[model samples]
Target: MRKTKKKNKIYFPDPKFNDSLVTRFVNHLMKNGKKNIAYKIFYNAMKKIDLIKEKEDKTALEIWKEGLKNVMPHVEVRSRRMGGSNIQVPIPISSNSKITKAMKLLISCAFIRNEKTMSNKLAFEIWDAFKEQGEAVKRKENIHKMAEANKAFSHFRF
Candidate 1:
């Protein structure tokens, strides 16, 4: 390999929660190189979630984490070419990138909602994820389904 594999940089935790996962999620949410806007959207969504949800058993942050867990995909299908034919090969997902994938799905599904503000949409999606039902969770389920359907090609995995 050229110059060995690039080292993984460590990310400092987010200010409010002191959690690196939050920082990673914010990084995924960032656009136009504006990380502050992403943080604002995330924190505001937590606040909105607090106001919208009646139960006080779980904190907003915990609920968000739960939502991310629900949306985490376990397996996926990757395209591979063999014998002059392309196939969808199912494979188990790597643990390290799982959180990033979940974060990306959460942000994308939040954006698809018809809510007035991104915060509200994110809050709703987070709440739905906590309940194990949401676009993001549906997306995870779809990924698993696709992987299962493509299991026949799993041997094609390199």
Candidate 2:
């Protein structure tokens, strides 16, 4: 390779959950370098989740992890050009990429939601994902379906 690959930076876990994944999600949720605000929103959402899903045996962090897993897409289609034609090729995604995609989808959907605040919208999205119903989950399902439908093009993967 002409250029060296960039090294991955280590992420410190959030205070409440002490989980690196939560820290990553909060980092993605952060805007304009407002990390404190992001942390507050994420913690508040987790608290709300705990308050609402009292009967579940899982902790709020575990529920959030499940929600993240629910929204993670295993395969995705990418446009590739070959023989003067463009084709949609299904490719497996790495775990980190899957997590990142899920986080982005969740945040985007949360932003579009008609909620009083960003934290509330994010909390609702997290709850819906945990229950296996939400825009983010639907998006993941759609991605999987698309990948399955285009499985015939798997041979075209670069």
Candidate 3:
């Protein structure tokens, strides 16, 4: 297994959006391998967005993409052992990992939100993220703050 690198599995685009990012989000939202349920939740959230969207022109998919973009973190802290003490090293996240992290954060924030259903909660989170005012966005800002605080550890890049 160590002889070669793991190959990336191809992700088919979601039928509704015809977009691979949507498929990726659905994958992260799936639990117990319930892909049907995950797809249902995402589709329902899109419907909610259509109903309550502020702008008259932008589509739900566009808003969702904006939300996802707003949630991405550029820099994050990693713990590094320096001598007997551990230091928090601020490192830049790679492009692929950043997208994955953004999707996961959006899903997690939606789960904790109070709403009648997962779809409704996800819709609310999406709208909040679109406006850059949700927990996911806050998490990203906090990561930047921590990274700034650990600026001295920039030399510890691995």
Compare the candidates by TM-score and give the number of the best one: 3
- Which runs in model 3 stand beyond 4 Å of their true positions? 1-6
Q: Arrange candidates by TM-score, descending.
A: 3, 2, 1
Better of 2 and 3 by TM-score: 3
Model 1 clash pairs are: none
Candidate 1 displacement at residue 86 in angstroms: 0.7
Model 1 scores worst on lDDT over the 10 consecutive residues at 1-10
lDDT of 2 by residue, 1-158 (tens): 98897778799988877888888999999999999999999988888888889689998888888988888889999999889998889999987788899999889888888989888899889899999998998989999999999899999987
Encode model 3's per-residue lDDT on 1-158: one tens digit a residue.
Answer: 65796577689999988999899999999999999999999999999999998655899999999999999999999999999999999999988889999999999999999899999999999999998998989988998999999999999998
Off by over 4 Å in 2: 1-3
lDDT of candidates 1 onward, in order: 0.90, 0.89, 0.94
User: Which segments of model 1 are wrong by more than 4 Å?
Assistant: 1-3
Q: Which ten residues in a row have the lowest lDDT in candidate 2?
A: 5-14
Error of 3 at 83 (Å): 0.6
How many clashing pairs per prediction, in order?
0, 0, 0
C-alpha displacement of 53 in model 2, angstroms? Answer: 0.6
lDDT of 3 at 123: 97
